[model samples]
Target: MIPRLKAWWRMFDTFTQRCLAVSVVLAIVASACLVQLVNVQLLDGRTTAEAATNSRTSKVTLSAKRGRILDTNGTVLAQSVERYNIIGVPDAATSFTPVTCGSKQAKSLGYCHAIDDKPVGATGAAAVARLLAPLLGMDAMELGAKLNGTNQYVVLKKEVTPQVKREIDKLNLGGIVYGELSSERVYAENTLIGALLGGVDDEGKGASGLESSLDDELAGTDGYTVYQRGNGGEVIPGTVTKTQEATDGKDVSLTIDADVDWYVKKVLSEGVSAQHAQWGVAVVQDVQTGEIIALEDSDSIQAGSDEAKLGSSRAVSQTFEPGSVGKIPALAAIMQSGVKITDQFTIPYEMEKDGQKFHDASSHGAEHWTLAGILQNSSNVGMITAAANVTNQQRYDMLCKFGIGQSTGLNLPGESNGVLTSPESWDTRSKETVLFGQGYTVNALQLTRAVSVIATGGINRQQSLIKSVSTSNGKQTSKLNTSATRVIDENTANEIKNAMESVADRWNKVINVSGYRIAMKTGTAEVAGDSGALTSIVADTVGFLPADNPRFVVTVVMKDPAGVHGGTTAGKVFAQIGEFLMQKYDVPNSAERTDAIPVEW
Candidate 1:
């Protein structure tokens, strides 16, 4: 085979051999080119194309519409409105030119660069500013200065209404001046529910109050759009390659009544001012549903204001000793232990028990008083004597059952679970003070709900502020996952109710609401003042209306008031709010009180 190959090679000339080698080399080069062509066209074509397109693509975030906050009666408390930010490309504005009239007839028609038919006689940034100044309510010279910058992008103005945006659009300053979509939150009742409604941050996220707590429900999923852009960073027409629609936030309806809240805030502010107090809080709740109809604070700041960002709702944040108002639970515990409201006690001005001295708010000689009288007079000494039958653990358990020393379940931001220590942690003095509401602390909402247990016939319903949430799919009622539990028997609740009614009857002059009966308890406690001394007073009143059949519970608290007594200061505010509630709800007149337990033996 080797000899035959050598003979065939000799048959060809040197030139033909060289030509054959060149042809073979050309064919090999062509084959390699073909392979590369196939690889590029079949294997990586899409990747190459995508890379080319991506270089010119732009993605824009689309803001989702934040949900509206509504009151129980469908009143819009807070809402997001369509707004626009006037964006100016300073580089583009420097070359901006307005359309000029080409003919005399065109100039007479006022279509040229003129305002009210007055010739602008300007170009570039000055002309652009003159066209937009009146529409934006800005000074022409100032606007011109903003447009004269060298930056590629500049925000001339933000949160302009849609009407103003349209007016600017009609000026035909297309590339020079454009609008970027945005939203502005507008509060209907400015400062009425300010603290409770909360406000959103600059980026439109909830910062506090209900806005922060329910942010997830209120802030829906934000979508985005991907599109091709021109060299100048402008989105090319019809070049939307990808898009995802924004999901608008769900509308949250609160149990609060806007009108009622406004009224309560007004009354509470006036009351706080009249008493020369530091601040005040008032809360109203529905007996059956446990809905907070109104929550007001004297120092309520406007929503979306700088001050609101720093503070929280005082009703759920501020904690103080409930004083005599804490006695009802002790009374309930004593009565539940088979002690009757008619049970008598020999009360003294002061008494010593377990090396601790206890006294009533006022000095009194030894007198025969029933258990009902002890509560009606708010006698701390009488409370100690009457509570002698109940154990410390029993008192602690009762207070816990009444929702003391715990969050009210409203889930408000900065809410405090007021300090309630265990029974074992209580000292001898604390044990006795706890009976009359001094050893522990509670927020206004906690104290309100505690009183509500009696009004609700011993059922401790979960307190809720958000009534429902409405979304794209449908409306969903907020389920707090907390069930109502019975704290006391119905008979015991009625007995406590009747005793509170007697207390209200005793202070009818200040607490009475005409045409309706009220069952109330007043409290006053000495807390640490600004100087850190026990000189400040927390005066509060908590009760339910139409004592015969309670419908609503109202609580009013005043801090460091001139009228150091709860019955006179906070109680007066309660009466005003109660009267307004009765009239607003059209509640029927209460029947005359037929059941009254005698107080004095």
Candidate 2:
């Protein structure tokens, strides 16, 4: 029995030992699996989604500058340049951090800090202010508080000079940064032609003048670049980025010649003062092509003050009774009506009709005066009598044909159509007064272009300011020169031109350059009061160079002045401008005079 019991005990001990070892191995394996699952489920990717969505990404879009305006001679009339902004990374800043950020997250890190220990240093604002104020023109203390960051970037200062930027960069202040931006408009010659060139706004948009008118062509499209980024919001260096290059604006070339424009304005201004007249305008245009060479007006718009102010573009827009200037067409009607250049009419000192008196400036008594003398002396009766013989219907037809009571179709804004009353309303007195230009209204440009019929050989080709326009797609469009329409016989117009040349004889006296036989006419247009009497006189001198082979035409008008006669006041300015023009353009001026009819009244 004892032996049997010993055997049983031994077997039980062995079984117990085996079972304990198996249990230990299983427990070890189970613990390993549990640890692996916990790490996979909760620890390996704690920040992946949070970092992807909550981590901020920042970017900036840069704007390209606008193209500049250049004169025909390549002078820069308007231009622009870049400005800069300085920034600071306050919260992400190492210097601004209360302590270093790490696995012990600055927020969760258990660390001992004194009550006096500020997140930004006690002198943080003062220190930052000290580092930046001198360089940025700012309050250092204010800058420090702004620079004191928990986890953010802040703007330090904006629009600092390049020199100041260089100074700031030299200091290497922690978290301080900069980005360049465009700023400032540069008028190369210092506002020499500021008003004409016009201005732009803060965003580089055109505001006035040629600049405003052509803004679309001047302002180009902006561009953008899109980039693929990685985990840290850093661009993937090798990955593809979608980039669209900015299309900059193309430069513009103007028709204006700066030197010639300056000279014209200067001469015209001096002449207006010398004439003692209210104001004046001088314009020179090509006879063949009708391109404007120079335009000068003393009645310019007074900027910042309206006293004695005159607006731009006077000649084409402002209308007045053309007075004797319109009589050229009336004279043409007479000549075209079979009146020869050597025709005759007895000039009367005062001619009365329908109870109204008409008289020439000089009271030369009625005597043997040819039709040529009648026109030369600007006699109202001679013009009326000559025009009266032609039916009112004939006169109206001729006037329309000559572009009277109509716009010259000049390529400028705000052009005027001169007043021409209907033929149906014409009484005999209306015929006479309209014949001498009292009953009609005409803008200066309209009359000037009408007179140009003489130079263009009876064909009037109008004037223009714009020459060309270029589009974004490289398509170029052009403004064509004036279209010519014949209004009179070439020979008859030339014959009248000979009579017109007599007008410049007075200019030759004041501006004696001893060259070029000019054809000119003097006009004194009295502004008729509502009560039927003359109120004021507008003096005008219209002329052309080298009458035989015409190249240019000019008109000078002086209004409501202390001086009396158009030939004396307006003619003098005419002569001065002509002399300078002939010299400047190298147009041939000879001492020989053309065979013109002698003046006798």
Candidate 3:
């Protein structure tokens, strides 16, 4: 009976141990399930499929429209427009068979015809190539080969018209997509201000000209977006979000008047066409404000382009030896040094120096002449004689003070400070030649503005493109000011004005309208070759209308053509533009003509 009891106890103990082992197993299984549930619901989600889509669902950035450029009167010069990019997702079309999609095919059906409903067999790359050729304007075979490339997302074309794009969208081509873009730096004037405004990059970023110079002001801040994405990089509509907003560029208003700019370009274009001249330029400035109203330039024709703003302001960038137009400033520099207008100087018939011949524009007498007569006749010898009274360094200094051989720092591209040899670099011939518009180079803008200083009460203010910028918050920040710089004295200023009037009255004889006193100067300079031989004369006529108290400083430089004379070509251009301004603006006539008698037809 005892043995039987022991056996039963053993059985019961074994049963209890077995039960505990089973319970431990069940507990382990339950813990794992709970942990997995927490991970999916709170800590993280499924990683392979859903997590991958989340990871790849990156936030894409968008660009805002760049600000428009307008003329002083609010005419559009440059602006930005909406553009787009067509993207493709090669995986979207399930019916597009792998063989037809430029990929190796599997014999089984599910893989190839799964994406799109399109048929699979005989219609391979060749047939699809032909269909894409005209639509894409691409070679069928080449495009097919590219479609075979590894990159699934690719750019098809750019600057596509919206009409064609709309038609394409209607076709409902599977796996194809579209994204936003911008066609920026669009010149409304279409090459009118091309060289001046310059071009932007594919991202609508500034590259040159005013666009580049003022890029900081004109360009807006770039923005970004950050959000959670699925494992496949696909955006999760419910979870993904955008953070910062993109800022658009600022609109800029120029000091330039579009009407005046149009006139300048039109007249210069006609001049270039008729004369068959290499190129030409006309610059207009406000004498009192130092504002560049118009700058028209031209270059070699591009066979088919019909743009006005060409040549890139050979006016501001070019620096050739200005033949005679330089005479006014040179002579003015001397007279201001106390050389009296009444002081007389006897000049030589032909001054022989350093194995070089120095002849006047014409043969003149070796007679005694006053300062006024010397300038009226534009006597080379007389100028040399007068310049002799001033030291070499003195003349150079005066030129420096006048802003020659120095950068104007104007807000423009391709500006040349020009060449000015110091006294140490000056040769005897150079010294003599410089006396009559040789041995040095000066740009059109600088020359005109130098005269402008004399016209605008001795203040040489810096030049600018942007007049003022009005912030989105309504505050206006002026770019340049009346007190930018002061370069000359008022007395010397008046004397120069007097001297300019003397030249116009005596030689150029500009049209003297009633109640208006005109001050003017005529300059005819011959361009020189590498051998220092005369190439062709560049005629330049620069004058200000209502000269007694100057208003418009018009300088015209007509490049090489047959009848090369500055007074004729540039003078005529000035007359037409001046007449247009006077009539269009209705600028009142000068107070009773105190300077000279009117020109009778």
Candidate 4:
């Protein structure tokens, strides 16, 4: 073959030989380039395909649904709902057209046609705005102006209805998009449980009340997804590359009884309005477990209204001198010091201590009475006489033991531990004043817990608002605190319970049901003005039902009401609630009658 090729080359001219050699070299170079092209297009196909898809795709952060807040009876107080944001890409929408539709122009444009327009029609930004304006309840001109802007992403409207979304889909507009998200905290009961359930802020975070305190448990983990986007910035079907499933937040159940809370709020609202007071609070707790069934704050901010400056959980956050209600704990302290309920003393209308005189709510001549009589009459002088048995430090310590000067451990945000001065901070007058429910302060919940000492046989159980937290994975975590510590002896608690029965007997016309034996105490404490002088009254009533074996402890507090006495103002509201609860729970009356305690001996 070499001899034949040499013989053929000798016959060609010099120009011909040079041209043939150049042609062979050029053909070799072309063959090498073709091989490299095949390697990139076929052998490394996946890498090239990925890079192409990535240029037109994006990752979107999907929000997880917030958990529901349900009452003990399974009534939902707060929940989350799916809402859609009407999104528009102004630059894209200005020149967009839906080229595909059902059985239209299949040969001309290779697919379908626009659903709302004719074949080869104009379906640009102005046309899209005209079709969507009436459906979206917006002016066509206004929508056109928005679509003419330079923004990459624009929110035309938010919280669009599902029905409206379906209608928009029927048009099949190319540039219009729907960005889905969760609604901001839909309250099932509206303002009824407003403050208690709290409100979610703009960042989807709980801002106050139980929502604020248990935000992490209620806010679930958000999910994410990466998908290829079409030319118009919309997610393409079947182009999702990566996905992480979203895990929803955990559900919360509170000890609150919705029915009981409704009734309590009803009566409190009426009372507060009738008295023309600043606000009112009503709290009902189970004596045995310290479960707060109803904690109604009448001054709660209305949902969607900018009415108040602070959250309305005044039942646990606001404090005032407990007045006559303080006597309940005082008698317990005196009894703890070996002063029997029947112990007699000569009580005067007013008594001077450290140059300051203390008097009862009403002035009368000096009279002789037993320990039970002092509490029944709410006599300040009688209490001062009994204070000699226990030291000031001992009384302060006793009050603290009953959950005063401390939070109730109920897990409520912004809870207050009232004004309780230590023994070292006591003035000379505090020794006498503290004995009669003064020189110290307590919130309505603290007073109710203090009164619970008598109802729960002296065991101070920890107060709780949460019953359980249930997750999306079927696991539940209980939040109830059943632990309790003894604050007084059983005998002392029973003795005070019996004595308070007399006070309830007197308020029976308003608070008593036809079949139940009730025990109660009325409080009328003076609230100091901003100038540090007594100016307003904190009328309140704290008590329990069925003097024999207590079931419910209800406290009603009215601030700066028309009536200064709790027996008349707060007692009316308490009576209405007590009657409702007795009927609602169908609680049985005591089989035995309350034994009369000797008032005078």
How high is each candidate's TM-score? 0.86, 0.71, 0.79, 0.87
Q: Per-model C-alpha lDDT, please?
A: 0.88, 0.66, 0.65, 0.80
lDDT of 2 at 464: 55
Residue 58 displacement in candidate 4 (angstroms):
2.6
Choose the strongest candidate by TM-score.
4
Stretches off by above 4 angstroms in model 1 are: 1-60, 103-111, 115-123, 138-152, 227-238, 472-474, 478-482
lDDT per residue as tens, model 3, 1-601: 9999768657767779789779999999999999988887776755555766554555556566576677778787777776665454333322233333333553442233212445433333333344444655778666555444445466656665566567555433434334435453457543465567665666666666666666777777766676664433344577646677778777778878888887888887787677777778888887767777887676422211222123334556777666766666677668767886667777656776667677677776676667666666667777877877777777777677667777876747678888988988888788777766777778888778766777776767676657776554556677655654555567666666666666666644443344455566666777775577787667677777776567788877777755676656666676677777667667778665354322211
In terms of lDDT, the best-performing candidate is: 1
Better of 1 and 2 by TM-score: 1
Which 10 consecutive positions of candidate 1 have the poorest summed lDDT? 103-112
**Candidate 4 lDDT, 346-462, residue by residue in tens:** 999987877887788888888888999888888988998887869987888888887777778776766788888788988888877777678888888888898888899888988
Residue 108 lDDT in model 1? Answer: 72
* Residue runs of model 4 more than 4 Å from their true location after superposition: 1-51, 98-123, 139-142, 149-152, 232-238, 303-312, 473-475, 530-532
Between 3 and 4, whose TM-score is larger? Answer: 4
Q: How many backbone collisions does model 3 have?
A: 28
Candidate 2 per-residue lDDT, tens place, 80-139, comes to: 566666777565333532332233655575442222333323344445455567667777
Evaluate residue 403 in candidate 3 and report its C-alpha lDDT on the 0 to 100 scale: 71
- The regions of model 3 sitting more than 4 angstroms off are 1-50, 53-56, 93-152, 161-169, 172-175, 226-236, 300-313, 346-349, 352-357, 470-475, 484-488, 507-516, 530-532, 591-601
Per residue, candidate 1 scores C-alpha lDDT tens digits across 1-601 of 9999889878899998899889999999999999999998999899988998987786777889999998999999889999999988788788866666565755675555667767667888998899899999999999999999777678899999999999887776766788888899888755877877778998899998888998998998888999997754678999998899999999998999999999999999999999999999999999988999998899868887777766788877899999999998988988987888898888998999998888889888997889888888888998888787788889999999999987777788878999999999989899999888898999988999999999989888889888888886776777433579999999888888998999998899878899999999999999999899998999999999988879999999999999999999999999999999999999999998777988898
Candidate 4 shows a clash count of 2
